[model samples]
Target: MMLRQPCSWRMIIRTVTVIGLAIVTACASAPTRFYTLGTDAQPRITSSTASPSFRIEVRPVKVPTAVARSQLVVQINAAQVQVLEDDRWASSLPDEIRDALIARVNQQAGAPGAGTVAHGEDVPVYQIAVDVQRFESWPGSHVLIDVVWTVRTSADVETLTCHSAVREPVSDGYQALVGGHRRAIGVVAAQIAKVVRASAASATDSPLRFTGAAGKAAKGISCPHAADGAQAAADSAIAPLEE
Candidate 1:
């Protein structure tokens, strides 16, 4: 006859096995994926051709509390929202936007560089401020962004305030939504570059102050002008070949 096992030992062993299986199942079912809102900035400029006179002071981005967390926000409806557990931003949304803007403005615009506020930092000739009022996505539908930005300089009495709403279509996947947002940001970056180029044209000290954006559409720094027309409701492509 074999020695009998204690009931308590068997129960504990069974419980431990159940917990291990549960852990494995959960891990298998919900693997986390990280994403960022970065894309090839539109209207890119080669290093040799870069032309802008003003150095823009990029202020810290302002994001509302509603969508400030790391998780991806999905608007199920006007009254409801879903925060995905497995799909998330690689960094805080505001920080991601700030980094994206800093990198893109430097590459796509004529600015020498961009920087945050530092001790004893010299005053900047031109300044850029962005407020992200709304950023959300409907996974099966679209990614939407509503942002207002202000451009200020030492010379102008009135700042140029502009609002942009970008809606990019996406398939029924969080990855697609991420792609949409990246392209949407690229579009916004292009707009800011347009304005900065204009300001450079109006300056006196910087060498690029007299240079203009090289095209019919690029009428530099004409503030007190109206905003651009509404963008398409569903544009998924980020770095389009046409640009």
Candidate 2:
């Protein structure tokens, strides 16, 4: 019987080192997944009958600093949060939100063009600014978004400020959580589209009517609910402020 000499200490150390390196390499090579708010699917909001004459320019969005990174930040508990390194946004959070809002608003409002004004063209431009006050993701529970948005034409004919808070229940996956946030954004877009459509109609009827601060105050437009398919059993509310 050949007695196997106890594995040499040097050999044991080398074997352990090689195993550790292999594990590290495997972990380092793990594929990262990226997500985007934009979707190719048909928009949920009902399209307007006439294409809007004015174009929409969605300004860059602002988000909380805690979730400003590319990685997905999720609330593990009331006091704890986790950042997933393997999952990231396709773009910065602000850019993602702005792009999503522009897409959904254009689709919902039936706007003719996006984010750009043709040189020397006499088309009205609606500038939409959004500030995200609270963006929370609770996986397997819900996703909440609190946003304050403002709409003003390039000519400054009228201004509308509104606040919207939407909370959507989600299932047990990251995809579902993202979907919930997408739907919440759609809800906000629907509210903004309502304002755009109304303003456009008013302008068509009387371009010079809503001109000064007094005229803007007299408009008294209330925030509207999410358009046809935009609301999905979500808790949402919109508060309009005359400006």
Candidate 3:
């Protein structure tokens, strides 16, 4: 039998280096994924020969500082969170939310055009402002969104403020988590649409009314759904950092 020679330290080091390089190359070559809040669902608004009643302008959205990054931040536990480097939003978090809200609210409210003055110049324009108070993501658990939204006339003569909190359950995937958040945003959009429709109807009946100090409060306006009601059930269906 021939005697076998032991591998030298230099050779072993070279082999280890090659393996490490290969691993690094593989990781570097891995494709990153981008997600958006926009859904594939068809717009609920149907074609109508009648002119649109009003228009909407969705203002820039405001999101919490904790989740302002492009990367998808997920809750690992109560005390910690994980930022997935390979997964990212197609746009900034605020932009994504605002875009989604604009699309869904237009669909729900049946607003023919958004942010357009070319036509319907005589129609009323409602400016929608949204401030996201809480945006939480928890993998294998649920996603929650708490938003304080306001709708005001173009002249700022009347304003109505409302709040919505939506929670959606998800399974154990990033896509599912994102879908949950998307549905939550849809719920918020629906609530805004309800208020918009009500406001428009009221405006047609009589002069827009305001309650409370400074004529900023809306009378008899509530969230579209209750905390534990059919709307919540229909929407049914997360964070770290104590949010």
Measured against the true structure, the TM-scores of the candidates, in listed sequence, are 0.72, 0.81, 0.80
Q: Indicate the residue-level lDDT of 91 in model 3.
A: 95
Q: Where is model 2 more than 4 Å wrong at Cα?
A: 1-17, 44-52, 115-119, 208-217, 225-243
TM-score: model 3 vs. ground truth: 0.80
Give a tens-digit lDDT track for model 2, residues 1-243. 898788899999999999999999999998998999885554544445444467888998999999999999999998889999999999999999998888878867768654444646787787898999999999999999999888888986566667788888999999888998988887888888877777776777665233334324245544565443255222222322122
For residues 1-243, could you state the per-residue lDDT of candidate 3 as single tens digits?
999999999999999999999999998997899999986763454222256778888999999998999999999888788999999999999999999888877766767754544553687788899999989999999999989888887755556777788888999999999999988887788778777777777776665654513424355654456442225324423111111
Q: Could you give candidate 1's per-residue lDDT for residues 115-159 as a string of tens digits?
A: 433424544476778999989888889998888877766554456
Task: Count the clashes in each prediction.
Answer: 2, 0, 0
- Kindly state the number of residue pairs that clash in model 3: 0
- Which scores better on TM-score, 1 or 3? 3
- Candidate 2 local Cα displacement, residue 184, angstroms: 0.5
lDDT values, one for every candidate: 0.66, 0.76, 0.76
